[model samples]
Target: MRLHAASLYYFDAVRRAGSIRAAARRLNVASSAVNRQILKLEDEIGAVLFERVPGGVRLTAAGEALARHVVVVLQDFERARGEIEGLKGARIGHVDIVTIEGLTRTFLPEALGQLHDRAPRITVSATTQGSDRIAAMVTGGQADMGIGFDIQRQPDLRQAAVARFRLGLVAAPGHPLAGRPWVTLNDCIGHRLILPDASLSIHRILRPLLADLPPGEGAFVTSSSVQLMYRMTLAGLGISFQTRLGLEPELARGELVHVPLMRQGEPMWSELGIYVRAGRSLAPSVDLTLRLMADHLVAVAREG
Candidate 1:
């Protein structure tokens, strides 16, 4: 069965927006036009793609199946266009990435900036998501790449590169724990603690460590935002625990101190990984970005 590009475009937009009117607004087309395209697609496929919900639409089983193929088809089309541009001596394309929130503060921006400086014609779009969602996006072909900690393992996703970082206590420069070589959970519980919320993989890793702490010894505040946790720590409200991946600026400026978390004098560590869909060939721009990211992660890992 063949579907027109416009029909597939409208179908994908409606799937994303959940409503024809909203998708029309996004596409800058009339709602009736979008609806006609969707109807035409359903007629060609001979399946009801969406179920009408009260305020929006939900995908049917057939819709779900088609959506997956649609994502791959659209991505392949974009890649082919990029290759054609390359053949014409123009190196231009877009790379879509989904990453964990922690990288936004420093790692991702720096890497993207470096890529832009070297390849001015290439553009990038990045969204911050939790590790699980990042993995799903990469596996489903919704994103070209994912960067996060402990990405969910899936048959269709491959870990392109990884770096291991020891989790550490972060505090303002003059905080009481600043000079410590390493600290145990028991030592940290005595002070106010800013903790990562369950959305972050770090929260899962640290859960067992905090589980044995005394009843009243718990987090002063919990949040999913790494930036918020860093700011609170800088304000001396509490100490926070995280990898050193995004802490370079603060550590370099002496704005914060990071002491490794320890158990029996051994540091606690977590793996940060880059993921891409398996059995797929990446576009040149996407491949370049991935290489740069892998190089950057390797540098950060060696800094430990």
Candidate 2:
């Protein structure tokens, strides 16, 4: 038995989907029924939750306030229901996770493979997002966990595990720097550079090292897309600097090589951490997966 009002679910669905019709489609219900419930909820609460906008609805201030509480309550309710089912020996649960694209190529797949063997009955929904969005999803109670490099710090999120990776100069096998053991900032000067822009955390890490290169010394193309950077590097448009996370497949195939970045003879690395919403108790299935991830990531981090 759910303790919260059913209208709250409708409100949340509409809020997330951005329209009554869309939310209805997702819920497999009629739009009028959904709209009716939201109206009833608005009456009961004596506040407007959403305002009509072109092609959709936007949450009002009251709706935003309610959303915060409603999401937490809904998550808590699901957790409680899952725990209660576990107490009855039922081996079923669902988990939602958000993470950066970087992990999708390496850590995520490996961890999920292990999770599949151990918790076959548990269902998982995973989404690819940047570190900032990943942290938001975890802290907003929309996702059970987040794994990313340089997740935006928030009061409602807590780190569960961590990993570190040195930034590497990714070069096509035909590139001049392809076979180097490592390259210092000085060595990369005057070469064409495919750089991730300020939107990505790598921009910040690269800023200090890249400062040594005088402006206009090297040809530079900047983008916010990691995939584009990888593609450009593969096409030999120029070399790009990145961590080894998403470069595993190509690097292993000898299509590309990862030349570690060093400064003053020391490697420069960035951090990746797993996060969860603070002050929430996880269901057994989620807890089990989390422990597995922590073990797996910590071991990987240790190797670097």
**Local distance difference test values of all predictions, in order:** 0.88, 0.85
Model 2 residue 159 CA deviation (Å) reads: 0.5
Residue-level lDDT for 298 in candidate 1: 93
Q: Write the per-residue lDDT of candidate 1 for residues 66-108, one digit (tens) a residue.
A: 9989887877777777787889987689998999888988889
Candidate 1: clashing pairs of residues: none
lDDT of 2 by residue, 1-304 (tens): 7688889899989987899999999999999999999999999999999999999999999999999998888888878888888898875688899877667777788998998898788889899876657777887777899887876677888998888888889999988888889998788887899987776777788887677778685547898777888888899989898888877778889999899988778988888888899888887878888999899988787765
> Could you tell me the TM-score of candidate 1?
0.93
Model 2 error, position 165 (Å): 1.5
The superposed Cα distance between candidate 2 and the true structure at residue 285, in angstroms, equals 2.3
